[model samples]
Target: MNNKIKSFLKSFTLFEIFLITIGITLVTTFSIVFGANPLAICSSVIGIIGVVFIAKGSVIGSVLGIIMSIFYIIVSYINGLYGEVVLYVLVIIPMNILSIIQWFKNVSQDKVTIKVQKTAKKDLIILAIATIIAIPIVYIILKFFNTQSLILSTFSIIISTVGTYLNVKRDKLTFIVFILHNLVVISLWIVTIINIQNLSLIPIIVNSSVNLFSNMYGVINWTKMQKKQNQKGSY
Candidate 1:
């Protein structure tokens, strides 16, 4: 029985873990020249640390991801990547909070409650109406989604607020959602690299390594946290 446990525990050791993390941070630090503001670089470092240690679906990663996401999305928005901006803007805070709620209690192995279904038709219809209102209101309530930052913020808020109207919950479709989200993220990464013509291969390689290992590093953390949770059940 404990043999299985021992193998799991052996996956990490002090030196191997420390060495890998330092490498990631140092690489990310080098990425500073690639349009990352100081705030973003710092957030990336912190976010990496947070995610690597916390489980992907865990509360810690969620909160940290949410906080860092705002800045990242803002940067994207300013660059006129409006599509991703609209999608991410709505969930920066909520996704993080949901992550916290999903993992807050660990004893419920019989049921998991992470993913919720897509909004109901009525709710989607309301959301659609809100989106419609958003365009014209985007001009009035804000300044123009293009003209003023302050006005743009209002549109962001409007979009964020309406989605809050629902409370219907469902068990997470973890098996499907997890794989899908991962694949999509990987695709996004590929697209990012391809579109970024300014980056030399060396920088791209470094960035890739930083991102990959940091996430792997994050899983180590998630495992540690899970183990801690498991151990806490004992005296």
Candidate 2:
């Protein structure tokens, strides 16, 4: 365990470590200050940790993603975000599991970090059509369930599904999609806070904000990984 910790620490630069630390600290501090739900606090911290691993193209990220999703499901359910519940349980967790297998099969020479790929133009077109078709269908379902922030919840599922698919496919575009997902989620949580005046939802906002920055960093990091992999003639 200690050796694994050391290796993980060595994989990142000081700046990346600092950025991750700041994110974890911000979520924890905000959760305590706002007296957020205990589940939200757990979810926020685990989410920050999980996403940083993901940004680094590490398979361990997918494992953490599964654990984080459970906490998130409970929190969202309590807040009447049935869309979130369904999205995580039915889509995100399964994608993360698939991601673990995919990443393992597509690792770099080090046999740990994933070898990232660029999404093909044809696939991008397909994703666009799929997203359009999925949105209205998801919207109808969310409305039927009387999910909170109906529009935001529907959009979140669409964006998150695409993002999770890209992640599982090891596409570098995953981070860009997730950045957009984070924005929609931030808006959804903000609306939730306003509607219920629940201070506990503050941690969700903080978690999403941290995720936004992490995904931005993921874009840069994955671009570098893609270039390196191409130069090595791998994947």
Candidate 3:
């Protein structure tokens, strides 16, 4: 356990650690300043930690992701973002579970990072078709639930589903999709805040903003990892 902790800590550079620390501080400060719910603050903190680990291709990220999703579900439920609740319960959690399993199976020589893969053309076609099919179905469901900002909810579902799917595939593209997903989420929550005048939800906005940067970093990190892996040809 001690060794594992050390390895996890050692996986990150000093700059990465500083960034993560800054993210946590900002999330906590935003939540407190905006009078966010305790759950929202917790979710934001966990989410920042989880996503940064994920950016590093660590299985620990998936574990933290599941926990963060649970907190997110409860927060979304209270705010009538039923689309978010359903998406997290049905899609995000399962994909995180699969990520844990797959990451473990594909661990690098360091035994901490997972091997990154480029999405194949066939997979891209399949994902595109799936996104098209899912959009209408998810829209209907969100409509039935009377979700707030229905259009935004539907878009969030599509983006998150595709992002998580790519994440499970260990594709570098996951972060790009997540960057879009975070934008949609930020918009969705901002709408909720305007509708209900609850400043507590601001932490989610802060969380997503932090996520946007983290995912951008994820793209850079994963691209480098993928190139290195390709050169080695060990996979």
Candidate 4:
């Protein structure tokens, strides 16, 4: 257990620590002020941890991602954010499982790092087509249910679908998709917070902010990894 704890701590860079600290502090304060929902708080924290781990290309992050999806689904359902509930339950959960399997298969000989892959042009085309199809379909469904922030929720679905697909493929483009997804998510939660004027939604706001930073970190690190791979190939 001690070794495991140390390993986990060693995975995080100083920048990651700073971002995580800020996210935790934001959530903690909101929880205290809004009368603590333990499940929401735990899910928020775990989700952030998972994002950070994924940024480092660790399989453990995918596992946490699956768990976070479950908790987030429950929270979204309770809040009447049916769009998020659908996304988490029907999409994110299953994708995270597949991601775990995919990452494991790509693990380095040392068994600690997962190799990132380049996105193909064909894959990009498919993602674009899927997003085009998904937006209207998701929008109609959310609209039928009268989901909160309907347009934004539909946008989230589009971003998340592309992001999850890229992520499972271990493409660096996933980070770019995540940056867009984070913005949509931040807007979605802001709408909810305004509608309910509750402190519980504050944690989600903080979670999105943390996600934005984590995605940026992922982009930077993955870029470095790609450059190193290219340099080695040149030799």
Q: What is the lDDT of candidate 1?
A: 0.46
Model 4, 14-106: lDDT tens digits are 988887788888888888898757878988888888898888888888899988888888888888889998998888888999899997777
Per residue, candidate 1 scores C-alpha lDDT tens digits across 1-235 of 8985786456545744564477456656566556544554544555454444332333444666677677657645544445446546655466556546645543233132122333466756776787687756555533444432443344444443442233112222222233233333334434544665433222333433444555444344434444554464421
Supply the global lDDT for candidate 3.
0.90
Q: What is the lDDT ranking, best to worst?
A: 3, 2, 4, 1
172 Cα displacement, candidate 3 (Å)? 0.1
Candidate 2 displacement at residue 69 in angstroms = 0.5
RMSD of each: 9.6, 1.3, 1.3, 2.2
Alpha-carbon RMSD, candidate 2 = 1.3
Output candidate 3 Cα RMSD. 1.3
Checking candidate 3 for backbone clashes, the offending pairs are 36-200
Segments in model 4 whose C-alpha atoms lie over 4 Å from true places: 1-8, 230-235
**Against the hidden true structure, what lDDT does model 2 obtain?**
0.89
Error of 2 at 105 (Å): 1.0
Which stretches of candidate 1 lie above 4 Å from their native place? 1-16, 23-26, 32-35, 56-58, 107-235
Worst 10 residues of 3 by lDDT: 7-16
**Model 3 lDDT tens row, 162-211:** 99999999999999999999999999999999999998788889889988
- The C-alpha lDDT values of all candidates are 0.46, 0.89, 0.90, 0.84
Ten residues in sequence with the least summed lDDT for candidate 1: 167-176
